[model samples]
Target: MTINCLDLFAGSGGFTLGLKEAGIKTKAAIEIDRFAVETFRHNFPKVDMHHRDITSFNDKEIKSNFTGVDLIVGGPPCQGFSVAGPSQYGKLDDRNNLVLEYLRFVKVISPNMVIMENVKNFINGKLPSKDKVIDVVTNILDKLGYDIKIEVLYAPKFGVPQSRTRVFVIAIKRGCGLPFPEIHETHGPDKKNYITVGEAITDLPFISSSAGYDDSPDKLTYNEIELSTYQKMMRKDGKGIYNHISMKHTPRLIERFKHIPLGGSLLDVPLEHGQRARNGTDLDTKARFKMNNQRLDPSKISHCVTASFQSTFVHPVMNRNLTAREGARLQSFPDKFIFKGPRTLMSKSLLIRENREHEIGLSQYNQIGNSVPPLLAKAIGSAIVKSFKHKVNDTRRATHEFA
Candidate 1:
């Protein structure tokens, strides 16, 4: 039997896209953002969609549409729980409260399984009372009669071009004994060599941060690397890339990009610029946050790419900010996914986001700052399918014995 999925907080349908690739069917999706909703609907024309706030939704409404979904999958808004934000796990973060809404849906639909993805920091610390994330998450699942298994997964380990680390929780019902996904491979056969920024974007065509073209639906090509495995897999249909949003950088930011090295950071730049060149907090000395740690090396992979531009997100080679296409590419978004809204939406988002210090009223850039890269989502989806298949086999055996 085909596994059915109900995707909540489905941003650009990244989780949905990966689940579909893993052979699960998305019966319905609930998303709150207008841009995300339009984009999800455009790509997934066949799936039913709910475009309203999840808080207002009721269990009876969901039951009316989906009776017994096999899986409930989503990455709820993480701004509240994210380290990038205030890092407040439980209090004052309204977004954090929404997780219970997800749990509520699970209580109503009682899906056979649940899959959730979030930032790695979620595992690094506790909620309140110093409780582990698993403790909190499992408590919710336990009430729903599901057994949860979790792992902090790195994307580069699973064939994604970028090095994105995220926490994934996979929960199966009590009777279903599903094993966790084993780490199959690491980047470059050694612990030292990780998926580099160069490997991820080297093949794409060069567009300066200052350039913009009228919206065109025709698929386009950038460079010789278009046929590479990553590109080919992303463009599964063999059509050219489409809807790759590119933004140019200002002249001043362009000058700053010239100072960053392939793996160097803002510290390498001059002290007069008022940029903090120090490493992260001097507490952990290793290069944990170095991936995109405020450098503009187009030759290197970006740190966690955000939808917001306030971070030191200039291009490594160009003087301008990273274009929307570059940001999307770093996030593992497929080229064909189109974003609606005016061009100024991109500009205003970056401007308002770059300066804001507080957690509230984040620009669109900050809103997308810590999204689960879609490429990583696909790998997690693969693992979920693997676990699900194993459970299906076990259930078959038990059924046969009873018969």
Candidate 2:
């Protein structure tokens, strides 16, 4: 009665890790990013990793290989439907069509269950063809005899120390009589309080912006401090601290950080210190994004970590930006889950100017920010596992009675 899964668009195996934690076996994964694929292969060496685009495979090829998969999980590129994407394009962005590619695989695989994750805006997004994305997906699942349930899950409520929210579409095949999985919130007012940023990362050793390197053997050993419950869980199987290196900020940038208080953003900085311009021209005007360079309030959950998180979150107490490991901790990634690839990447403009777009790949920060929190995924996966076990037990009892 083991459940086998095929993970599509599996960036760095976040979903795979959660499924594994929930006692589900991820038989295979497909990812297009070379660095992410390498990370996935490194972490999940036994899984069949396909390092190519999902659209490259025809329906016949998918069916021939993934015919018996019990579950299919994916979070297709959300840039097109994300609120962070360019608003001018809105639903007309070409990347929004990737959902169709996701559906294509689902149609061919016809797994017992399907789970799709995306940014919160995905619930209201529409394709270029003037059809709502959710409506289109639901119609297809309905035609395929699936019972669909969609929910927007909040990360903090699920024990993640980040205030991120995403939409999940869960579909179970008809005739199984298995109701939708019940994913209960474990960290809220009625339950345990939400894990705080301090609880999630305060245990890691401190390092200056100039300390640590990418993929270097140099690692800061953990201190013998009293560990929090969240810290104990994170360090359960971790060998040592890795990817805890901070970004080297300019002296001026460090000075700017001095003006911002805890939970304060760039708006707190004086205009003389190169604050962001308002209306693209009024540099003297006090206007800044709440997400940009905001010092973390250690007492509460963190703001959403986006793919550009390399420059998004300032450290809670330090006058530097968060290291890749700190962001990973906020996202509920265990300490043992080593992120592979460059620590950071050049800006998109620089890459384009230097004609290095072809060499583009996900950096450690990008991979961390792009991932679903493993703890949240585990909660959802646990519910699915519970329902599956229940179905299996009922089937066994019925067979015994018949015989």
Compare the candidates by lDDT and give the number of the best one.
Answer: 2
Clashing pairs in 2: none
User: What C-alpha lDDT do the candidate models reach, one value each?
Assistant: 0.63, 0.86
lDDT of 2 by residue, 1-403 (tens): 7899999999998899988999999998999998899889989999999999898999788987776799999898888788778534543787778898998888888888999999998887878786889999999999998999999999999889988999999999999757789998888764249888898888776777767655553447775789889999998887778788888888988998888899898877887775545454535544566667899998988889889988888888888899998899998889889998888888777898999997688999999999989998899889999989888888899999999
The TM-score obtained by model 1 is 0.80
Per-model TM-score on C-alpha atoms: 0.80, 0.95
Over 4 Å off, model 1:
88-91, 124-134, 176-194, 217-220, 225-227, 243-245, 271-293, 296-301, 309-311, 342-370, 395-403
lDDT of 2 at 127: 85
lDDT of 1 by residue, 1-403 (tens): 6778899888667778767776778999997777677667877999989888888777788788777688888887766566766565344354666666788888888877788877776665454444555567779898778877887777666655455677878777776576664435435465445544555555555666545443553534567753545555555552454434455545644565577665576555544432333752322223223433365444444565645544446555545555555565566666665544333343444556786433223233433444566666666667767777787898899999999
Tell me the number of clashing residue pairs for each predicted model.
17, 0
